[model samples]
Target: MDHRTQLEERIAHLTRHVDELSEVVARQQSELDRLSRRVAMLMAREAERELDTGGSIPLADQKPPHW
Candidate 1:
């Protein structure tokens, strides 16, 4: 193949690869956002449980047993 033709093929291949990678990254970002929201909700529920049990320390502020 001619030099110009080879260059064009390489460019096309790279472009496709970049597009595929972008889609993968976008999917990961969406999944991460969903997981983050779930974690926050779970944390809130734990805090409410602690309050109902009459625990004064917020779960986040409490030190570990080793401390």
Candidate 2:
């Protein structure tokens, strides 16, 4: 094959690879976003449960041991 033809083939192959990688990255981003939201929801629920039980005051409001 001619040099020009070989270069064209290589370009096409690289383009296809780049497109596949982009799709994989997009899928991973979506999954990460979903997991983040789920974690936030779980944390909120736990905080509410703590309040209901009156287990303890929030950490920031408590006095240090030395006080």
Q: Highest TM-score among the candidates is held by which one?
A: 1
Q: Candidate 2: minimum summed lDDT over ten consecutive residues — where?
A: 54-63
TM-score of 1: 0.87
Give the C-alpha lDDT of model 1. Answer: 0.93
lDDT of 1 by residue, 1-67 (tens): 9999999999999999999999999999999999999999998889889989999977956899999
N/CA/C clash count, model 2: 0
Clashes of each: 0, 0
**lDDT of model 1, residue 17:** 100
lDDT of 2 by residue, 1-67 (tens): 9999999999999999999999999999999999999988887777677778895764444579999
Which candidate has the top score in lDDT? Answer: 1
- Each candidate's lDDT (Cα)? 0.93, 0.86
